[model samples]
Target: MASDKSTASLTTASSKAILLLVVFLLTHTLSFSQTTTRTYLVRLRDKVSSPYSVSRPEQFLSQRSIQRRQKQNIAVLERDLPVNPAYVTQLQQAGAKVRFTSRWLNAVLIEATDATMTAVQRLPFVTGLEFNRALSRPVRSGGRLGAETDTKFGQVQTAINYGTSQTQITQLGVDNMHAAGFRGEGILIGVLDSGFMNADEVSFLKPLFDEKRILATYDFVKKETSVYEDDSHGTSCLAAIAATADGQLYGTAFKASFVLLRTEDADSEQQVEEANWLFGAEYADSAGVDVISSSLGYTTFDDPSQNYTYANMDGKTALCTRAAQIASETGMVVVVAAGNEGSNAWRYISAPSDAAGVLCIAAVNQTGQWASFSSIGPAADGRVKPDLAARGQGTIIGNPDGRIASGNGTSFATPLVAGLAAGFWQANSRLTAVQVVEALRRSGTQAGAPDAQLGYGIPNFARPLATEEPMAPFVVFPNPFSDGEPLTIDWQTINANASVDATLADLTGRTVWQYRYQPGKLGTLTVPSLNLSAGFYVMTIVSGDKRRVIKLLKR
Candidate 1:
């Protein structure tokens, strides 16, 4: 009895130490100054529910209840088989490269390469070859439509302004629309998460529920109607862009409706957990939900056999991708986490998020540098990913309880953008999902071109500018010129015969002056010397295929 007591005491101490570690980490991360709210995860103690009297695992997690029924083996042979230190040896014996090995999953996802996929069928114990994919992301909204109306739920928590600078998440193209009064009034967001606590008590959410905003909720793990306890991760994610309080955590869309789908199984590590997510999305779709943003992605599994490798991050390898794809096609804008594997060996975004057409978001720091943990991409298909950026690193978060905290992860960044998109849709309710995405993409600060690291850079809150637009030209010394200096117009382009596409306009797009571009064969063209006015003016060089718009300034 003494030994057992000692063991239990030691376990308790260990748990406490872990809890302290969590607090320490969160305390040290950078948080945005903006008062916003979202829910988040904390290392929590397990409160055990007594085991079933009978072997009725079906009571809560049966195939029908949880939708995690065991699936038939379908992965190709190359991905099967264990890989250890002897991975090379195993590959050498098989006459294959060692690249197939996935150290994290302790298994290999080999490729046939020159070998036909049919070769995999002949291999012993080999299942069918399955393709992996990333999920699709949502399109951007144009702008805000109105102020959020007071609801029975009182002031709900929102964290929209939390991390646009960090993660560079810009898919929320029309986030300003939320401020304009489009709060996803008729839309529904399904949160397939671990648990919920104090969700019923938030004031802003009361009106939504009272007005039947909460369509439905289901607990896949417990198969219950209530999921309002224990988990704070989903709540935090939801708050990133959806929560709203007058002075507290403000969501991009303070009035968006939500449905909590407790599909994640925090206790277990298996393929079935992924299956649960599919079921949750399916349920949400059937309920006519408008948008789905899941801050979850899977590549590595505790069990070696079920793990995915870097190459498997083709956006289609996992079950999650299959469902995420379907959700998007159904017209529900889907935004998925880009994964936090920046430091991991197989550090690329995982499935569903890697799926084609999904706008993956990478986390960034305040200075616009890539967040160390933001998932890397150039998806296996060779497409640059993280369609855009948003604040993600060390973002402030709200929990299931009315408590506020800060966190860092693609998980948090995703919802911030999602909420913004919801707000956009609310602003232009007539906009289709694809239209929303295009507006957001075009509205990007770097929409003219995109690459892997920071897909489209950060977003501009105003109307999205285009590369082809025509404007005026000006020569301002010390570009981004300081105030009070004679805005110098020294240039070969400003030669007597040369003409500058000199036309200035205000924010409202009214042409202040128009100076036509004169054809010139010279290497450079300069407009006539002139003192330029400031307060944001566009100076354009209108040469065919050479359209450059430079900003000017004056004292």
Candidate 2:
């Protein structure tokens, strides 16, 4: 009987050992699976209601933000609320490592194994899921990415010389606006791009730093605080707007305050970057920015399956475009690059540019001709896109290394236009964001006849500042005269002794032609055409304190 009990005990020990080994193997397999988990974008259907209230917007919005909305008659809606904390907890409970959350899209990015993802999808709040690529590798220190390069470093000079930037700013009449003391003072601008490498160290941007105009910065790509350590594209874009030095170089809105945001992942092109852009824009809105300048556009991605077709250029199709529209509705003027795809296969304006009510900028050369690489557009809905054009080809930029160099892309044009828009708005403080946009469109050389290639044509900042008088009714026929055609002006002179003076100036406000005449009782005056270049010209008609500015396009 003792021998039988010993045999039973040995059998029990052997069975227990086998059971422990099986459990260890299963635990190791589960650990391996978790480590190999993939990242995904999980969209939630709704958020928990307990923690947030749309009526109490002060909790989420700054005082300036609240003031801006009040001025524009915009309401703080439920969409502006932060994502519910309960929903995030639920996602975390499902073994999802949350990376980012977008209140605008009501979505959260998570990392989880396939089995865990399956479980996450089965949750009641989960509406859908998509595979998001792994985080892009961080750029190596001092490495150049995209169109930014460090070759121009060490070439910076101390004296003020305008350099190659003069042509770009002068062509848009931005210099005249500067002369009027409207250099973006009292205005806040948000610059959204990949990175802002060396911006703090550049000489031209020293004023922005010295005056503490860089109000805030955030990096959405790496989820870090160091935007100056990444790509230099943002540096170039900012230089186009806020870089200022005595005579050497000056940006369009040199005196404006700034909020620098790193929204793009320069290492990779993906849809996730668009979400980052949306988040950045929302942040900008909450900070009370008057304008947003975004050089990034989307259509193609590293994953071909995630690429957007031309059909998606519809104003609301692209997620970023919807965000831009919302931004416009929220009272901030948004400017975007029309795109540099003119020479590529997908030759159309990219999204956010297609968004309605936003100013889409196209690239033009110093000669005021459209750049070959500037994307063309009639948005999918048939609205003429690229509301304006700016000098982009060979645009001078203050590089990260303190050197001033030239770069080419619509990316440069967007900020040039954005800065000038700020100055224009500064000149007329009473103009709403929508009114300013309309004024810009009307100030374009081609306002009378807009086309897809150049949209309304290049904008003239000075033209928008002209205040109209109700005294005399003046009209110019065949206004967009050819180089050799005659211009006929008819006006109802309020006073018989009133002298009529006509001046034709280039975009720089330089008087190219001037004439003085006394209108007859018939109220008609015809001037023979003089030699003029094929470009945009401002025709200012002044008759005894009643002045009118007419934007003319010469063929």
Candidate 3:
């Protein structure tokens, strides 16, 4: 009886040991599987209980953003609200790590294991889940980690001159606009790019920080405030618009307010970056930016299967293109690079640039000829792409280290055009966003016959300000007059017997000077002395009921 009891005990101990071993193996295998992470796009059902409202846009949007929409008569809609916090919390609770959230697409980017993904999908709030890409080691181009280091600082020039940038600004007639006292004052521009390393440290951009003109900044890749710490691509692009060193380099809209956004992941090419761009655009819209300048483009990715074909260049196909169109519809002028694929196998314009209503900028040389590297296009939908052209080849840019360097790519041209647009908008604040785009297109040198290579050719800022009817009943010689100099006016009274009532007002319509003249004939009237600050102004001449308002530029 004792031997039989001992045998039973030994058998029970062996069984328990086997059970313990099996459990250990199973747990190890589960942990190994969980360690391999994959990225996915989590599509949420709705933002049902969002902590924002369209009626009270001030709660979510900046005062400038609300003002921009109001200026263009764009209404605040429910789509502008933030995503529901509850949905995000529920997602986090399911063991999935959420990276970025895009309210425009109503989606969230998450990283998780297969089991976690299954759990997330089973949740009621998750409408669908699409595999994005595997989260492996970043495949950086040239195997470099951070932004390319600046080696051109040693080649700095001593003179404070525009250097190679003269042709670019002068070619677009922006020089004339600058002389006319319109240098993007009161205009807000948003820059969306990969990174802006040393942007805050650059000498040319010092005024932006000092004046607090940099309204906002966000990094969609790391989901942090490290926009200025990333790649230098964005810094180069921003220099084309906001750099304000007197001679070394002057960006197109140097005086414009800026909202910098880092939307690209320079480490890898993926579809998530497109979502990042959409999020950036939505943020810019809510911040009340007037123009969005993006030098980033998409075509191929690190994953072969995720590569976009030429057909995807259609305005409505790419995710970024759709977002850009939505941005334009929301009353902000969208400017994008036409891509630098002219000599490559994929020689075509990229997304967002193909989107209609957005000003797609192509690259050109100083002589106004198409750059060999400039992307060619008639968008897949047959719309004329690259609505305008600007200097891109050998374009001058302010390096992050305070040196001026020349870069070649449509990337440089996009900001030049964006700054020009801002200056034009500043000159004519009464024009609607759509009207501003149309005026720009119409003012192009080749407006009558536009081609894919050069679009409407280079835009001339003076063309848009030229009207069919005379600006006023009188003409002012040397219209952009120096502050201490006398102004010569050639006037002709509309009513022979009526006296002439003349008033000079600033751009804000505040009367700065008033003069009443007796019944005047067709003759030149010289004002001996006039004191006015440098800016744009309006001179109104009233002859009885016939009043004429003419635009005036003060130096």
Candidate 4:
């Protein structure tokens, strides 16, 4: 009994000592100025019951979002529901001004005075509170975008003349993917960054505006709808994915749609921006976005007390990392920059990039060599980070001032991979978001032997598409078979004498239809109708000893 008491006392003393050490470090580092208002991450105990229901998700989720989840076999759980309104109202009544609420984390970001926070803590529903930062006026953090350069690399062409952007585009075989007609059509990408300065007026990107492809824009920092008035960093990042200028510049997924979100604040390096990112992620998820491409990363904060150490890069420590993981889990491909800290004292990848579910991209030059400034990593937990590399060094980008220019940073590399992912996903529309991430990694140049510097190395977009279907010897046209249209199966490669046996099954593996036929005569088979419901199905075909399984999406 005495020994048990002693152990408990020792543990208590050690925790207190650790808490004191933290206080001392905060006091010695950057001190906070006297401020009346402070922002906090308020954790709630329970979601309780809300106006939304899991049975009727359309009340809270978009129709497209519901379909994505349905196709992925992901359930609509209580966690997907919004926070209890009564809880938020109670917090507001307690003098805490709500900034944003995260359904995934079941928390609220609120700005409140010390006395108001004390009152908020007394609320029965309040579980805990984490101080984010003081609500002080912003001080500009010197522009953090990749440095623009005058030197340009040599260009090469294939089916499309990319001009200055050819090397970067071809390095990843994105041009070949484009040649195959998968130019990211129907894919919706959400870009969360600092801001898009002149994206609204940029010449190469004007087509997106004119075509109504710029679906939405939101500024989280300023809490506004216009994202065209802030930093130019986001504009350049967008150009790396969606810009289109014949012989001068061409983005990898130029035909895809986009949602512009300003989640980063160029004027400050604070933890609140992470909260803003979480908000952006939730918005992207709710908007039925297929991909999230974020060029922003976080490491050190203006308030030193909130700075992260290398130990914090464990994929689960930071809020943004957790949010990125959740976003991936919700069936969105999360792509992030590996950061430009390779030469800095803290030479490592940043949060969100460290997230396991996210595809972190490193930077390589036009020559396919690792860029010196591209952040390196074996995530603190020992997982190979920067799952892929792309041309970022002297890569062509569109300037906010409407000029085509070259820049160097993993920021550019990220969107290059993001665009490729958009196009790749367009080609493999039946694959889940997680499968798309894995397919990209498998298509990497060094996929057989990955490393920290370049991870799996630069991806080859054309390789996977070719390898995935070469042995099948068959093709399905109008794959996501539209209603009132015939589903056609053409076999042009297999021997005419081969016997074909095909079976179609629902996602649950129950066979719905089967057909036995000889391709020797017609070489094609047309089914007028299968009368399938709107969801994903699997079709297995066996020609002699060879077997092939194809995923089919029925709409």
Best by TM-score: 4
lDDT of 3: 0.80
TM-score of each: 0.56, 0.76, 0.78, 0.79
Which residue pairs clash in candidate 3?
65-288, 160-247, 161-247
Note the Cα lDDT for every prediction shown. 0.55, 0.80, 0.80, 0.84
> Can you write out model 2's per-residue Cα lDDT over 1-555, one digit (the tens) per residue?
999999999999999999999999999988887667666667777766748787888888888988888876788887788777798898899888888776667778777886787789899988886433443233222111125443342223322355557788788888777765678998999999989998888888998889999999999878877789998898999998998755546899999999999988777776767778888999999999999999988877766666788888889888789889988888898999998888879789998899998999998888999998888988988998978999888777778888777788889888999999898787656557887788788778888899888899999875543447654577777744665778887776645577778898765567889998875435666768878764456788777767887766554
lDDT by residue (1-555, candidate 3, tens digit) is: 899999999999999999999999999988889777777778788878788778898987889888888887889876777778888888899998988777667788788888888899899988885434453334542111112333342223423355556778888888888877788988989999988999999898999999999988999888887688888888888998988766557888888999999888888877777777888999898888899999988887776676778888889888788889989988999999998888889899987799998999998888998998788988987888879999888777877777877788888899999999999888767667897898789778898899989888899776533433445556776776776678777766466667777788764457889887776554556655676665556677676666666666665
Task: Please give, for residues 1-555, the per-residue lDDT of candidate 4 as tens digits.
Answer: 999999999999999999999998887552442236778888888877677788998988899889999999989887788888999999999888898888888889888877788898899988886443453334554224366665544455546779889889889888777766778899999999999998999898999999999999999888899999889999999999999987878998999999999998888887778889999999998889999999888888766677789889999999899999999999999999998999889899999899999999999998999999999999999999989999888889989878888999888988999999998788666678988898789779898899999999888765523323446457777765656897787766555788888888764467889988765745576666877665456677677766667666565
How far out, in Å, is residue 132 in model 1?
15
Superior by TM-score: candidate 1 or candidate 4: 4
Candidate 2 weakest ten by summed lDDT: 137-146
Residue 85 displacement in candidate 3 (angstroms)? 2.0
Clashing pairs in 2: 160-247, 160-248, 161-247, 161-248, 162-248
**How do the residues 446-488 of candidate 1 rate in per-residue lDDT, one tens digit apiece?**
6768877667765543452343544445344544443344334
Candidate 1 residue 525 Cα shift, in angstroms, is 30
